[model samples]
Target: MKLLLTSAGVKNASIRTTLVDLLGKRIEECTALCVPTAAYAMSGGPGAAWRQISGRASTPMSDLGWKSLGVLELTALPSLDADLWVPLVQETDALLVGGGDALYLAHWMRESGLADLFPSLRDTVYLGVSGGSMAMAPQVGEEFVGWKPPAGGDAGLGVVDFAMFPHLDHPDLPENSMADAEQWAAALSVPGYALDDQTALTVVDGAVDVISEGNWRLFTP
Candidate 1:
């Protein structure tokens, strides 16, 4: 699978160039699907979070030159079923997944059967922001310093081998600090990546590359 996972969407020239290169075309020529399901999971039935995610995600894309952008409300999709989304997803050159509550996003991914479809969509460039990145991993734990959601079962989709903790040291986000990331990593059984706002991890054909304009670190179990 080709994945560009970021704390914040495409923050630097290096990352933007990488994306354009991966698309095999200029940003303007590519078609994309913006999924704000994660934001919905945290917004609690249509509010500020929901309103902000799409624009926040798309504004950057527009600035970068992507002309064709489609917003997808997974909950409103014919069904959460992959069969329903596969054709539409296949038509897009890439996917832009917004972030909010990781577990909430994971739950929908599973319920909609999207988690099971990821491997098949390996050819599609998947760009995940914040919670979107974390939810794709094998396991995602307390992303915030003191915020823990109810526990019952698996916490993530397990699409990727490692866990991701985003927004490390971001000024506006309280849960986002390198120290908190380390603490969260220590509690995890698997390896993890801690990324600041300007950093991202790009995975292509099993290879991982760190793309950063800010700072990031990795933790091993």
Candidate 2:
């Protein structure tokens, strides 16, 4: 599978170019399914959440040059079943996962059976933004998001080998600083990457590449 795990979602030219290349066509010709379920999971509601998340996703999604299929409530996918939603995913060129509650998103992706289908979609690009990126890892540090995991380690989708700590040194989210990232990395059992808004981690097949316009660091034991 082709993956573009970004901190802020196509914030730099290199990342955008990479995504367009992954599509293997002009941006205007492709269509994407924007999964805003993570954002909805953060809202802690089943009803009013959609309205809130859709509003938040508009601007960042516009930067992704394709006709969006609006929002797919991945949290609700389990009950809906693949017979209903699988076609939508199969038809779309990519999955643009918006950022929010990483753990919550990870839960639904597994439960909804989307995780099972992802690996099969080798030709489809999977673009994850912030929390979306974190959800794709085996496990991630929740300190940056001010959330506590269970007493034991919390597992993510396990789609990728490394854990990600995004928004490093972001002035607005001071908790997501380089110092905080270092602290988070120290506790990680697996390899970790600390990425700022201008950076992204791209995985095509088994190879990994870092695309950056600002700052990024890798910590490995």
Task: List per-prediction Cα lDDT, in the order shown.
Answer: 0.74, 0.78
Candidate number achieving the greatest TM-score relative to the actual structure: 2
Query: Per-residue error at 11 for model 2, in Å?
Result: 0.9
Model 2, residue 7: C-alpha shift (Å): 0.2
> How would you encode candidate 2's per-residue C-alpha lDDT over 73-94 as one tens digit per residue?
7767877857888988877887
Q: Write the per-residue lDDT of candidate 1 for residues 137-207, one digit (tens) a residue.
A: 87787543222335654468777788888878877777667788888899888889998888889888877
The candidate that wins on lDDT is 2
Give lDDT: candidate 1, residue 10: 81
What does the lDDT come to for candidate 2?
Answer: 0.78
Give the residue spans of candidate 1 off by over 4 A: 43-54, 57-63, 78-84, 143-151
